[model samples]
Structures are given as C-alpha cells and as structure tokens.
Target: MMEAININHFNRHKITEADIIRRILSGEKELYEILVRRNNQKLYRVIRSYLNDEAEIEDIMQNSYIKGFTKLYQFKLEASFSTWLIRIAINEALARLKEKGKLYHISERAEELNKNTILEIPDKKQLNPQDKMIHHEAKQLLEKAIDQLEPKYKIVYMMKEIEGMSLKETALALDLTLSNVKVRLHRSKEMLKDSLFVISHDTHIFEFGFSRCDRITERVMENI
Candidate 1:
C-alpha cells in the first residue's frame, strides 16, 4: 500500500519540482502525488475564478491533473510547472464554459464594462463571536463581488491578487502580456474599489480545506 506523503516532506528535503517531475517521468509515478498536493490550492483558486459550482470545479480539477499527468512528457523543464499546470486547468475550465455556451469573448473594453460597482467592507477586528460573524459576512460579500466580475478581469484578479502568483507567471499562465495583466488587475481592483469603502486583504476568501484537497488528490491518483 502506498502511504500518503505530506508535501512538507518534499520541502524538508529541498527537492525541486523539476526533480520530482523528472523522477515521475523516469517511472516513479507516485511522486506525482507531491505535485498534486503542492498545487491543489492554487489550482482550485484558478478554477474557482471561472466556475461557481464546487462539484464542477472538483471534476475539472481532477480532469486537469489527469490530463497533465498524461502529457507530462511534453512539459518543458525550463519553465515553471505550476504555470504549465495552471494553463491546462484554465483551458479545461474554458472548455467547460464553452460547452455550456457560457464562454464569451470579452474585448479590450472589458474594463469599461463594469464601472458603476460598489463593494463595502466594514473595518472590524474579529475579537468576538459577533465580530467574527461580521468578518465572515464581509468575506462572503467580497467573494460575491468578485464572482460577478467579467471573466477576463476576474481571472486576472484571481491569479494576481488571490493566488499571489507573480506577474510574469500569471501572464505566462493566462497567455497575456505583462502590461495586459497589470491593466486587468488594476481595472479589477478599481471596479471593486469603486463601491468598496473598506478593503480587507484576506487571503482565505475562497479557501479549499484539507478534506477536499485530500479527496481531490486521492481521486486523481486513482484515475491516473
């Protein structure tokens, strides 16, 4: 029986992602679990930016990982594996949207589309139960506002702001120019800030918990 390996073990050994991929391609197939565990959060966030359905997002994520594994030989070692994987995930999500007729091209004028939007967050510390509730509600509101954004802008925001991916990596993943990524990110913030009196930089807005992470990893490992 294969034991579940914690990603921290990889970190402790200072094993690079390239090394893992090399080993996986060299017949150490189980090492792929390390990549899955390492990227589950980021993959979930990127896919969540496109689709709102949790089950659908998990399905797409599983398919993306399986697809990526099958195509591991084609992955360029000099490039970032996360970015490559994200590109695959994004393509999968877009294909899903296209199948449902929800995929629409947003022109360069997407920044001008949603100008009159407002999102307000109350500036309160979560010192007590009541304050915690308020904070939770505020996060939900912020997530809803993000979800309502056009796909183009929302994707940029999700990658740069929510996922904390570098500008270069985000551009590479989304196939956008650096300037375009900056522009979309700025416009996304402006769209949200127009009505957002107070902003909270909560990174845990669309958190994918440990249980779901394990489930996704197990399912993908089983299928692959």
Candidate 2:
C-alpha cells in the first residue's frame, strides 16, 4: 500500500531521534527547522490538546518553538527530538493556560450551556425519534466529567488522549518522572473511558474520542 511505502520512507531515515538532537547541538540551526516543519502541524495539535482554541493555537506554537530553539543547547540527546519538542510545547501551553485561565473557564461556560440549553433530562418519559437522538444530552455528561478533572489531570487527558502525547513527553513537559506521567496518563485514560461510557457503549466512546480532527493531534502515544 502507498501508506506502507510512506511509513517505510520515514523509517528509512534511521538517523535516530538522537541524531536530530546532536544536529541541533552542533549549531545546525537550519536543521531545527526541518524538525519543526515535520512536526509543526502536529505540534499545533499538541498545543491545542490543552489550550483548546484555534485563535491562540499559532501564538502558543510559535512561542513553544522559540523556547525550544533557545533551549536547544540544553537538549541532552538522551531522547528523541520529538520528545524534547513535546516538552517545550507542553510547558508553553501550561504557561499560556496560567496567563489566560480561560481553558477551564470556557469549559465551565460550556457546562452551563449544556445544562441549560443542551439537555433537559426529560422526566420518566422518553420522547420520539428526534428526541431519542439526545445528542447534546451525551455531550453535556461528557463535559461534566471533563469539568471535574484537575488542571493537571486535564492536561494529561488532552495530551495523552487528545494530542496522543506519549508518557515520556508528558513527563518531560511537566518535568515530572516517567512513573508519575504513566500514573496520571493511565488515570486520565480510564477517567475518559469511564466518563463517556456512562452515556454510550465502549466502542462508540473509543471511536468518537480518537477520531482525527482539524485540530492538532500530537500522537504522543506513538513514542510511548
């Protein structure tokens, strides 16, 4: 398949992620652009993973890249360039999150809208076809579940599930240990699964949750 060939080409590069780090360390600034371009779209998804808005995605991404470039010297080459970049992206998102404090705030508004406009929890009697759709009903529940998450856990959910950030990158981004990232990510995954499962079947939750979108997807799970 064509997909197989493309993946093969990427794998053939074999320079190893560590090689990219060395390139950055050796003053090959231009090469850093290669990494950025390769992952730029993905990095955008990563930023949106936690930040959750299209308007600010670019600002956060650019800021993250600048930070990564400035800190390129500190890169130890112990992990893939992707991992390091992810950490920078996450830290930048976290910083912006603190500044705006709108991530959770917006979610709160969404919850209110869901409660008031989206769902009525129809008492005792189920309605007809259109009413059975209950589309927003499920969404309200899912949003409520997400609303209950701590900021840190919310980041984990976004990075791990939404952006697909790997455990290593999540830990590095938060400057936490691998075990901590794993624990948090695991909890986030379970929490998400449980949250959505309440409104629908497991298969539906899995598909709806993982489907790709115009928003960025970091695939953090790949490296993990």
Candidate 3:
C-alpha cells in the first residue's frame, strides 16, 4: 500500500530534534513550525489546566512561543526540546496568573471545592443511545471537577492522567521534586474519585483542534 511506503520513507528519512534546532538556528526560521505543530496540543493542555478562559490560554501560548523563539540560542542540547518548551509555557502561564491577581499558593488553592458530596456511579453494561448521552454528560462533569482543582494539582493530574506524561517529565515541566509531583497527583486523583465516583476515559477533555493549531503556527511564524 502507498501508506506503507510513505511510512517506510518517513522512517528512513526521520529528522531528530537536534537537527531541526541546528537548522532553525542557522536561519531557517520557518522550520519553527515543526516545533509548534508537534507540541501545540500538549502545551495548550498545559496552559488550559491553569486558566479557564480560552482567549487567555491562547494569549499565554502566543507569549510563550515568542519567548521560546527569542531565547532559542540559549537552549542546551542536554534537555529534550519538548521538555524545554513545556517549562517555558508553564512559566508563562503562572506569570500571567500572578499578574491578574488570580494566583494562589498551592496550599491556599487546595481548599476544597466541595468536601462531602457523593457522586452517583454510571452503570457500565448499557450500550444503548441513551447510555451514550449519559456517558457524554458524565465526561463533562468530570472535566468540571478537574477544573476546580488548585493549579498545582490540576497541572500534575492533567499531565499524568490526560496527557500521558511520565512522573519525571511532569516534575521537570513544573519544576517540582518527583515526590512532590507524586503527592499532588495522588491528592488530585482522590479528589476526582471522591467527586465523580469514576473517572471517564472515553472522551478527551480540553482538546486542541487542527484549525487552532494551524492558526497558532501561522501567527507564531509571522511574529518571528
């Protein structure tokens, strides 16, 4: 199949992050699109976990990318490019939160959104169209509960649970110790389980669409 050949070709001609970095540093600035497209979804989720407003999230992302590109010369080859970019985005999001006086310390933000509400568990055996609608509603409720968490725990939970990042990667992005990341994630999970009765894995929360990715790429390219 043509798809098979294309896959083989891509594998054979694969580009490493270091190679792309070198080319961009050598003045092929447009190649920055490669980085933006690759990391857009992860970075979007990272910023969204902190701020609820979509416009604010996008503004933070734009600022982060511009900051990253300007500081590209300072990047060390020792760290993965994705990891480095994630750290930059996280810092920008926190800084914006602070500027708006919306920031709270981890301890302060951990004050319970709701301490004693028991949630109803959805039955799993049902596969009818009605069940599907209920499933969708359940997912929305889960997302709402997650959004109520403190930013520290929210970021940790989203990174580990939704974005599939390893504990080490989550710690690196947030500049927390491994133990701290684990503690926050554990507490976050407990909060969700207590509030939702069950976490839904059937739907993605806070997805970044292809149109927005393309728009972000275009905007970053123009600014750089």
* Residue 21 C-alpha lDDT in model 3: 84
Tens-digit lDDT string for candidate 2 (1-224) = 12335434545776565666676678655445445545665565466556546657766666666677777778776666667777777777777877876544544332212222333433214567665566556655655565455566666665566556677777776688888877876665555544363453222322222223212223221111
The superposed Cα distance between candidate 1 and the true structure at residue 125, in angstroms, equals 4.3
lDDT (tens digit, per residue) of candidate 3 on 1-224: 12335434534677777887898899977667777877888889899888879988888888888889999999999887778988998888888879988777454435665656666656658878887777678777778878878887889988888888899988987889999999998898877766373454433667789899878877887898
lDDT of 1 by residue, 106-142 (tens): 5343444354544445556546887777777878877
Residue 189 displacement (Å), model 1: 0.7
In candidate 3, stretches whose alpha carbon ends up further than 4 angstroms from where it belongs are: 1-13, 105-129, 194-203
In order, the Cα lDDT scores of the candidates are 0.84, 0.56, 0.79
Query: How high is each candidate's TM-score?
Result: 0.89, 0.55, 0.83
Q: What is the lDDT of candidate 3?
A: 0.79
Which run of 10 residues does model 2 get worst, by summed lDDT?
A: 214-223
Name the regions of candidate 2 deviating beyond 4 angstroms: 1-12, 24-27, 101-150, 162-169, 177-179, 193-224
Q: What TM-score does model 1 achieve against the real structure? A: 0.89
Best first by TM-score, ranked = 1, 3, 2
Give the backbone clash total of model 2. 5
